[model samples]
Target chain A: MMDFGSFLAMGGYAAYVWPAYGAALVILLAIWIDGSRRRRAVDQALHRLEQQRNSER
Target chain B: MHRFANPGRFLRLANRIQPWLKALTVLGFIIGLYLALWGSPPDYQQGETVRIMYVHVPAAWMALFAYLLVGLASASSLIWRHPLADVAAEAMSPVGAAFTLIALITGSLWGKPMWGTYWVWDARLTSFLLLFFLYLGHMALLGAFDDRARGQRSAAVLAIVGLVNLPVIKFSVDWWNTLHQPASIVRMGGISIDSSMQWPLFAMAITFHLFMLAAVIERMRTLLLEARLRNQRLAAFERVGTQARASE
Candidate 1:
């Protein structure tokens, strides 16, 4: 079995391999976070509008 | 499918499926990453750089898959005037665009190490770049007008027209000489990739699709809420206008 250090080395292609995976991770997480954040913001705005309408009535 | 075209019903279904979908995504990534990083063998020629394919291939596939979806949804929106379809097409544009960006960046990264260049203006790469622009154009059209329906209708037209690029992107590698390799998994003969590599690739592909679906559902819900908010504000404005007229 390869040692821990060698595994991290990725057979000398670590620079290319790690960054590719890292880029995918970042992009995927960004979409997930951005989607949920927009959803939450819109939901909150809708809620506030409804509450204001009720109070006025 | 048409039955669920009602946004309320679709939102309820979305809410129910979300937790399960997220859990599966997390689980799939755990397994997929393990196989991709540890279990899979390095390529004989590409060496450890082949690991990039685990992420790059799935992302490229999703980029195309998402566009295909946007195209189909746009067609439905244009033909049937389904509001849900408009929301769907609009919601998926950014997701598809993000995946396309990932594919481009990672492909470039892989290209640098293997082909000794970050980019080339070959048919496959060029067509894929056009796919990214189509997504941007679709999103831009969606918000171009004050009238939401008009904006959606216009965007739907653009998206349906852009569907022509899908086949060109798919066939470009075959039809032209390019640095990008031709199809390995979906050729007429069968998948050329080894079974050992297929496990992580397929797992990551499935996980990416689930992630895309989850993101789309969330965006769809937001669009629905925004529509409701618009209607509510309009009604409130009308009420105030009526009161002002009565007092005058």
Candidate 2:
């Protein structure tokens, strides 16, 4: 099992390096979630409108 | 591609594809992080600080790729007037900017330790900072106008014109003496990277691409819906006007 020190040693600047990598993942994931949610909301609204159009027809 | 040119068809495709994209993104990240953080060996010189490559390289790559996508879509919009192409191009800005921001922020985070400074005025670093501003300029130019069409047209022009910066970013290391290291991993020459670390870096890069695509598709769906809703309102207004005239 790898110890915490080795983990921290990602090459030596663990404090600066880990967070840089970590934050990239966090930001991209957040953007992904936000985008997916926006898409879902749009799709639902579009479906309702499509239904309205069909009813009118 | 034409099958997806229609907004209705596009919406259907997006709805189906989005979930799978999300799942893949999650899986990619999990696998990539493990390989990068645990599986990869430490560099003799940089030691643990080399771990920053797992994030920095991918973000930087995506930032450039996103702009290229924008330029390509802008060409499509201008040449063919493809129905929703402009919307797709416009929606890319925010996602691209977010990616660029991630790249810049993480670069800054990584630089502090490696370069011993958060930022430098070197050519490569300056050009990258310029590229980020170009993205912000595109975002602002697209929204500043009252007419949406005008805004989109202007933004597309700007994006196409801004393609010059991509080459500048690519060549900066060679052209100038910069603090930023030359492209060792992705050089046109054979991969200079060792076998141990190369796989995780490439995997994370792929993950970044898929993640970017998922975001773009989602934003495209929202733009299409917004456009459709506006059309619906206009159609409703016309119907009401005719009915009033008939009654009079």
Candidate 3:
């Protein structure tokens, strides 16, 4: 098994390395989550509109 | 391109491709991160810090690539008036900005260890910052007008004009004496980096590209749906208004 301690250490550059990866992960996650939420909201609105139209018919 | 110009057709195609793209992105990230973190040997000179290049370089590349797509889409929208091109360009702006932001942040993180400073007024770095602003400018211009067409047109113009910054960013290291290193992978002669490092970098770059594609397509679908919803509501309101008038 790889030594978890040294991996975290990243040969003494952990402070720089970990934060770089972390920031990227967080930003990507935010974008993905925001997009998915927006899509769901729009989809729901469309479905409601379709249902209303059907009922009116 | 013409066939896909229809938003419905485009959305259908996008939906089909999205799941595959998502899978590829996930697989690439897994392999790339594994290789970058442990599989590859540390650089002889920079040691493990060299690993930062995998993330930093790919983000930088995607930033430029996304802007290029925006500029090209803008060109098509302006010239041919392709129906989907404007939406494509608008959808790409925030994604491009996010990549640019990532690039700048990661570049700073890398710089702190290698260059002894988080930032310097280097040409490459400065031009990249300008590219980020250009993206924001494009996005803001899009919302500036009451008329959506006018907003899109103005943003398209900005995107085309911003093309000048791409070459400037690419050539800045060569043109000026700067802390940022000159091109290594892409150059006149050949790639300078070792193969051990190259594989992980390529994997991460591909992953970022796939991720960007999936994100843009998702955003476009949402935007198209929102536009449709707006139109539906307007039509419903108009119908109700006409009925009330007839009843009166």
Cα lDDT, all candidates: 0.91, 0.83, 0.92
Worst 10 residues of 1 chain A by lDDT: A15-24
Q: Per model, how many backbone clashes are there?
A: 0, 7, 0
Tens-digit per-residue lDDT, B13-59, candidate 2 = 98899899989988998888888888988787777767778788888
TM-score of each: 0.96, 0.90, 0.97
Q: What is the lDDT of candidate 2?
A: 0.83
Query: Per-prediction DockQ scores?
Result: 0.84, 0.65, 0.86
Q: Over 4 Å off in model 2, which ranges?
A: A5-12, A44-57
Pairs that collide in candidate 3 are none
DockQ of 1: 0.84
Clashing pairs in 2: A9-B48, A10-B48, A11-B47, A11-B48, A11-B49, A12-B48, A12-B49
On a 0 to 1 DockQ scale, where is model 3? 0.86
lDDT of 1 at B54: 89
Q: Model 1, range B106-151, lDDT digits (tens) per residue?
A: 9999999899999999999999999999999999988899998899
List candidate 3 segments past 4 Å from native: none
